[model samples]
Target: MRAAGRAAPTSDPAADASDLRVIGRVAPHLWPPGDREARARVVAALAFLLLAKFATVATPVAFKYAVDGLNDAAADPRAVLLSLPVWLVLAYGAARLASVGFNQLRDAVFARVGQRALRSLALSTFRHVHALSLRYHLGRKTGGLSRIIERGVKGVDFLLRFLLFSIGPLALELAMVAVIFLVVFDLRYFAVIVLTIGLYVWFTFKVTEWRVKIREKMNAEDTDANQKAVDSLLNFETVKYFGAERREADRYDRAMAGYEAAAVRTATSLAGLNAGQALIITAGLVAVMAMAAQGVLQGRLTVGDFVMVNAYMIQITLPLNFLGTVYREIRQALVDMRAMFGLLDQPPEVRDAPGAAPLRVGAGAVRFEHVDFGYDADR
Candidate 1:
């Protein structure tokens, strides 16, 4: 998805269709145009991933059938146990093999796409930063600007990885599982799962959003204090000569105290959020178990059904937990991305004029205009 670079124009419709199929198949509309080689790699990687997710979904159904078979042959303990091992081996083996293949493919694709993306971002930032008029950079804190860029680049990578890999498949899995529960067992279980998931998500956002704000403020204060500390250390002789060591120490203490308070506030809020999540998960588990027990007492479900329900609950919750975290991170990432793109959008003060021809080698002469520079009035 490196869209910044120039792309070759394709005059052949068939070729263009082939290229688009590869892009849609691999990255699935996540990133924009990229180099030709990278697009091919992405297509292959996506095909592998599609198969892998199907394998993951099929595994549980395998267990469901194996359980039904065992229940039918309950009289012969040997036959039941034998069927169990075969099914387990098949399901586990298939999943493990698919996972390994997917990982290899993913790594190869990541290497190519990752490098290109980083290169594009770095070049964009470097060119933009240098092109700025002096007054603009002077008005901004260089250290703060640097931090913004660092966080922004990292955010882009995070979004790309999760959007295509984790979020999409996990969402599909959740929907399928819900349908299975609704169609096979009881729709009530689906309701329970969805409800718990909703509450879990609500708390995660409310808490993380609050914390991110506090954290940002704390970070800004910390950066200012750090800069001051560095300034003092660099001018240590002057500080001692002016008898200002105690004053600098007091300033540092105040900064640290504010940081500590903000940290405690964030921690306390998170603890409360975690406690709420745990309570929701525990309640959901108990409800599912109770329903399973009732089904067993009424002969509506077998021991295998109980096991399946429990397993499904676990699979459902794990992703629910993940979704909660991902949601929070995404909100923060969006904020970070805005700042990064804002930086990226800055137009250069001096750019090549349209239709400007390149200077011919050995035929150009260098010239300097009457340029004046000043750092400060004191200079």
Candidate 2:
């Protein structure tokens, strides 16, 4: 029998696959073959995504024009109040609203697609678990199995939403911002933005990889604690008869203690990651703003140009700030999914011969001929 507070073993090969491979396994469910309606929703959602990103990028430009218009009409207070600045301000507001509106529309359209994928994978996993042999079921902890499936389903939903919406949109916005910097500003500004982004991404991935190991330990302890609690509760009559309540509680507490330590380590590492990311982003912001200030003083750029540059920097870095969190979660999600998929990879221990005919009896007496059956053949 498997010991309490220990995770069941899974297929190493399945668990060892890359995150992209895991994602590929999920892609068919998200965009199923020959499903016209689902495909249409996905297309519509992507269109809305593009629209939202376009509006998001345009918002700062409108604000820049409004600022410049106000500066030009500074001598005429009435013109400042009731001229081109007013329209540009209105356009800015509209662009902001459009960005938000399109994002919501995208979510609304894509909700069904994500839900369908979640439901499909969940049902498949459920069926697979049921199909496994009794020996496999007896060897595994029920609570840990459920936890794996639960986490895997949640990971699928999160991956579907973020991979399509957050990561792709962030890349598109960065490319647009890069072009703006090069065309409107100078190569120096472009270089700073690129270098900062590169470093931030590199640092986040490296740190998050370290954190993934800690998170895995935490997850293992979580599973162990859950398994013990469940096993104790399910066999409460046995515990009562044996008077082992204290023993069960001690086992649970030990598992929880491990989980607590792992959790603390995870949080501590996260703090370091956040601090490092903030430092890099702050340095980049300072460098860009300093250059913009120099440009303004030298008459090469305007107050509006400075404001626009600041807006673009904020726009790019804001998502980047969350990039670390998103990437970490994605990695963790892949791990959870790998465990669940490993369950599906397990082959059934008993199977009929290929093309075996179904048994048919008219008047039959069951007979055992040369029987050779043992639960453990070595025994």
Candidate 3:
């Protein structure tokens, strides 16, 4: 359980109760040094990720080769006598396959380790909750608490896998793309791409924070609406006895109306965010494209180079959307995970003695049929 020699987290009444530091606390359990196999799995996953990244970068290059080859063949039909175009086409497909193959392989390798971590967190929280005092359970709602547990389970899994596979990998790929632009293309391309991404991120974070607040309001209203409906249904007999069905329906409708308005606001704001991100990306693409087109006009770049530049930008830019999604999800999910794991932070009212030994029994040991316990003399 508590990572041998490590004391369990205690409830600190004086501690800042903002975020529970969920990721920080539970992340280490994902690959405990005690498990050599987990370390190996992570290493293997990283290797696959590296290969996937290279393959992804190479895909645009292969496309460029194919495009250039065909363009040359067309310019000089005599060159068509050679079948290099055919091979280039095949190379393009191979590059695409390699990129996809390695990405899937990376996910497969890391999945088990992520699940193992999820299980550990689940087990730790499960045991911790059972160890807490009866009052904690008495004060909880089974339905709401179970939902928290489910979402928390999902949160931990997503946090581990997404951070490792999505967020971290995307950043690495973007860096690699920037480096490629600088080394193979031009500095202007690199600068434009970087600046655009910076603005895109800044704009997304700013708008997304605003949207998060709206979503929270919507969720709160939705929860209130659901609670009203549930309470109304459960007290149906009372409503019927009083002939208050119409009144109950009116209250429920009012609650839902509030929720509907909040939901609409959330949808409307999300559209704005999407539009802003698209504008940023499109502007960046146009700037880069203008540079690439100029190279073509000057005969400094072949059609293939233009195609490659476009392809690479598309590849690099697609993840910008996911990067924003990941940032928002991590913030939201961590909030849930913090609450779920907060149960673990509650100091157990009961625990073993500092050096308690296991109870010894003979071959035929008797077990108690009934037991009694107490917290103190007052109880």
Ranking by lDDT: 2, 3, 1
**Best-performing candidate as measured by TM-score:** 2
* Lowest lDDT 10-residue stretch of candidate 1: 1-10
lDDT of 1 by residue, 74-180 (tens): 77877755666466657756775776677567767766776566567767777788888776786777666777787667766666677667777777777777778
How do the residues 293-350 of candidate 3 rate in per-residue lDDT, one tens digit apiece?
A: 9999999888888998899889988778666677767666676687787767789767
Cα error of candidate 3 at position 274, Å:
1.3
Per-candidate TM-scores read: 0.77, 0.90, 0.81
**Clash count in backbone of candidate 2:** 0
What is the C-alpha local distance difference test score of each model? 0.68, 0.85, 0.77
Deviating ranges (above 4 Å) for candidate 2: 1-17, 350-373, 377-379
Candidate rank order under TM-score: 2, 3, 1
Cα RMSD, each candidate: 9.1, 5.5, 7.5
Segments of candidate 3 deviating more than 4 angstroms: 1-20, 75-82, 221-258, 357-379
**Residue range 1-379, candidate 2, lDDT tens digits:** 0001112112245544566678889989978999999999999999999999999999999999999999999999976667999899999999999999999999999999999999999999998898889888878888889999999999888888887899889999998898889988889999999999899887876776556556778888889999999989999999999999999999999999999998778666666777888899999999999999999999999999999989999988878978866766666677788788888788888777999999887997889999986584433
